[model samples]
Target: MSMREVDPPRPSPARVYDYLLGGRHNSKVDRDAAERVMRLWPVRELALANRRFLIAAVRRLTREFGVRQFIDIGSGLPTEQNVHQVAAPDSRVLYVDNDALVVAEGGNLLDGRQAGYIEGDLRDPHRIITHPETSRLIDPTVPTALMIIGMMHYITDADDPAGIIRDLMVHLAPGSFLVVSTATDTLPDEMRQAIDMYYRNPAAPLVWRSRETVERFFDGLEPVSPGLTAVEKWTDSEAAAGPWLVIAGMARKP
Candidate 1:
């Protein structure tokens, strides 16, 4: 489907994330859902922390690891300082998401740029990895960075999130980087209850994992410094001191 198609009135995970990040791309349904979530936990702060983690990881990949290609799976609505914006201007980025609104909005944001958007689901990594746009922009034999930020928790065990990551990584060259941040089940009662509110939406139910389960997503890679820390603690920025409910880490394929 093309961008001209009007999306249905369901609350999209991307739009809900946009609302949490104070972006204007969300609809009334998203805003209402976000407000409901905020009443239970520090959703805005957590979202901002995750965003900061993504920026830090991308900067590290471009500056330290010399990675010029990026595939952001489950990349949501474009916000301030997107992946391509954070990396070098010459870097190539392909934003992938199943949400129609995300694909439409991301395509608009990436207009005339080296970056592009693919409307694909993470459960089917082969489709995303082998898509023509992905092939056109990203060379599979070259080192690339993959960002799975803020999306994995929605993928339950039935979907085999670890297998999904492994399948995607198999197509990437050695030395490729994987940056991931996922929600954990180790939250307080109130926070858990708040997260449960999201289940009310027809969208995928949140599948909070334990720290051990989340770490399994990085199975074949070596963790970067300060391995699998909270999103706020992933870097030494001021945002590192903020409260975060998600664990984030960066690893390199061997």
Candidate 2:
């Protein structure tokens, strides 16, 4: 699949996110939807902060933890400094997204690269874990980093997000890592209005959680340093003042 195969008429969260990140894979509809959200809040800044956190997390995992494989669930359209690009050349990355448009665009962008993209939803952890592409690229016996950045908020409580995380963790090695970031309910009224605008779109709905609830997802895993802080504050590189809309954390399976 390629950029030409992307569904331009339908606005997807991934495409809108790509637009927010200043990537070229988004359509006019995506740009319009992104603009609507940005008008109500600093969504562009938040998204950039999230991206920076992802890069920092990847570098830390690869350089410090010596992790060599990554499974980026809900990875949107590939942009500059992707997971594979940030990790060592020997590292293997499997990018997964529920959006077909994202899969197509990512496939095109990752062509000739060692990374692989697969179309899969987060709700079904087994399907993604057992998929041929995933199995072939990732070794379950070795420590792997499972990244769920900026996407878990879409999984409503009804979907049992904690259960989903536990299910996926069961398949990983004991030393594997879980990296995640999700929107918190602790937002200003204006940002709450922006979330409302996001709900108006047909894309995946959000289920904002509090800091406590988000931390629950890391149950049984040991949190890394400076546990569960704002995305910009996760590392020293991009620290800044904030109405910190989202919380991020990384934990290791013990």
Candidate 3:
């Protein structure tokens, strides 16, 4: 009998993140990837903190700033307390992700009325900005929240993540918001071993950046309260000062 060829399982960042969040959508490869990263860092806690920051930012935008539209680019697999759920009932959201599984799952999870999911690459900001779902849900003339949570580190310097932000923001009206969270390069040598692990695994390798490099991604925008801070500290005034593994911030395009 001839043996059939079997392709290897590829670990997706979205699925790895879902695994870290204790979601059931991830495959075995993603679970292994998350577990390997957990050996060097508190991957699960970091994921929770990032999700909290996103929730807080979205709430602030909807309640305090009166933002009715959201474009969450690189938005991962949906879990509890999604943007449209946390936002005002009348608000509309468009969740964009490059991962096919993420897009498909998100489409199934969200109501097409208030929220929609589409396939989009972070490097191609224009396509997302002008996507049909974005056009249907987001008003370019009004303030919108543009969120890129826990995904920017996947975009290497050659991809020009800063430029992507600028291009996306250029299409939004003044007072629009930008919320971002990314891995920091402040990890100790021992902890940095996880970076190599990702590179070797069937998962997406990250390009961790210094605080300075990340700050540049918000150039020409006004920082929200607390400014750029650790993800755990972004929403909590009493959260301990960091040597944190992940950092996040919210800014407004003035």
Candidate 4:
């Protein structure tokens, strides 16, 4: 499809997240919705914390693991300091998301030779990781970091998110890492329900996982330092309302 078809000058996950993170690349609808969600927690730190967690995860993978490739599943709209920017510059990142607007908006931020965008849904990581275009950009033989940042809550348990992570991990090399973060219900029940109810207005059906349930996605991997902690607590002060109650972690294969 043409760029217009993909972007459509519309609202999307990427746009909504951009608004959440205080970026300028979003539509009015996105901004309004994002504001409503943040109101559920009554603080802007929620978005900043999520972005910080993502940056830390990417740097660790790039510097410590010497990883040069990434497959960011549910990769939303690209903002400043995106995965490619934080990764080794030589890194080739294949971003997959169902949002055509995300592919459109984020696609323009990259030189397709190094950073590639594919229009694919989260439930279809198989097709995304194994797609012909991704094969051309990513060398599966080398270890890759599969990122599932801040997007899993949109999926239901019936979809078997744990199985999805396992299947994706099975396709990677031994040294590969999976970096993930998702919303959890760590706040007062009313606040958690408030945020969930707000997000219900969006295109995806969000299912906030508990800390225990979130751990299930890391089934066979080695948990990195500060394992399975709240996204903000992993490296920040999430003292207020658990700062939106999101869980995040990095795990290595083998």
The sequence of per-residue lDDT tens digits that candidate 2 reaches over residues 1-254 is 54556667757888888888888877788888888888778789888889988999999999999999999999987676779889988999999998776787788788545689999989999999999999889999999999999988779898999999999999999899999998888878788677667554445566778888988999999999878888889766457535558889999999
What's the lDDT for all of these models?
Answer: 0.84, 0.86, 0.82, 0.78
- lDDT of candidate 3 vs native? 0.82
lDDT of 4 by residue, 78-129 (tens): 6767798788888889888887667777788786588888898778768876
Q: Write the per-residue lDDT of candidate 3 for residues 188-223, one digit (tens) a residue.
A: 766668656764444556688999999999999999
Say which candidate scores most in lDDT. 2
- Which run of 10 residues does model 3 get worst, by summed lDDT? 1-10
List the candidates ranked by TM-score, beginning with the highest. Answer: 2, 1, 3, 4
lDDT order of candidates, top first: 2, 1, 3, 4
Which candidate leads in TM-score? 2
Better of 3 and 4 by TM-score: 3
TM-score per candidate, chains pooled: 0.91, 0.93, 0.89, 0.88
What ranges in model 3 sit over 4 Å off?
1-8, 199-205
* lDDT score for residue 148 of model 1: 96
- Summed over model 4, clashes come to 1
Pairs in clash, predicted candidate 3: none
Candidate 3: deviation at residue 90, Å?
Answer: 1.1
Please identify model 4 stretches exceeding 4 Å from their true place: 1-11, 201-204, 237-244
